[model samples]
Each structure stands twice: as structure tokens, then as C-alpha cells.
Target: MPSPYTVIEIFMTQYRCKRERNARKKFSNVF
Candidate 1:
């Protein structure tokens, strides 16, 4: 099984990707 730290890192990466996608969508709307 994966360690807790590894699981947290994975979640953080996913959250970051989601945030970036939302930012891109917002920029596209403005432009």
C-alpha cells in the first residue's frame, strides 16, 4: 500500500491541475 505522504502528494497534484484548468477557462472567457 502507498504511504500517507504519497497519497497526499497525489491529491495535491490533482488539485493543482484542476485549479490550473479553472484558471485557463476563466482567462478564455475574458479574452
Candidate 2:
């Protein structure tokens, strides 16, 4: 299995991508 840190890093990247996508949608709606 992967190390704990590796798992966290992957989770963080996916989470960040999702959050950025959501933020973009909100910004587009506002503009």
C-alpha cells in the first residue's frame, strides 16, 4: 500500500482541484 503521506498528498491535490473548479463556477456566475 502507499504511505500515509502519499495518500494525503493525492487527496489534497484532488480536493484543491475540486475547490478551484467550484470557485470558478461561482466567479463566472457573479460576473
Candidate 3:
């Protein structure tokens, strides 16, 4: 089993990845 901090970090990374993908899509639309 993973530690609490590790699980939180993993979730954060996934959230960041999703945010980055959305940002890229928005940026592409601007140009």
C-alpha cells in the first residue's frame, strides 16, 4: 500500500496533467 503523502502526490500530478492538457487546448485555440 502507498503512504498518504505518496497518494496525494500522485493525485496532484494527475490533476496537473489534466490542467496542462486543458491549457494547451485553450492556447491552441487562441492562435
What are the per-residue Cα lDDT tens digits for candidate 1 across 1-31?
Answer: 9999999999999999999999999999999
Candidate 2 versus truth, CA RMSD in Å, comes to 0.4
* Candidate 2, 1-24: lDDT as tens digits: 999999999999999999999999
lDDT per residue, candidate 3, 1-31, as tens digits? 9999999999999999999999999999999
lDDT of 1 at 12: 100
- Worst ten-residue run, lDDT, model 3? 2-11
In candidate 2, stretches whose alpha carbon ends up further than 4 angstroms from where it belongs are: none
TM-score of 2: 0.92
Clashing pairs in 1: none
Model 1: residues >4 Å from true position, as ranges?
A: none
lDDT of 1: 1.00
- Give the C-alpha miss distance for residue 18 in model 1, angstroms: 0.1
The C-alpha lDDT values of all candidates are 1.00, 1.00, 1.00
Winning model by TM-score: 1
Clashes of 3: 0
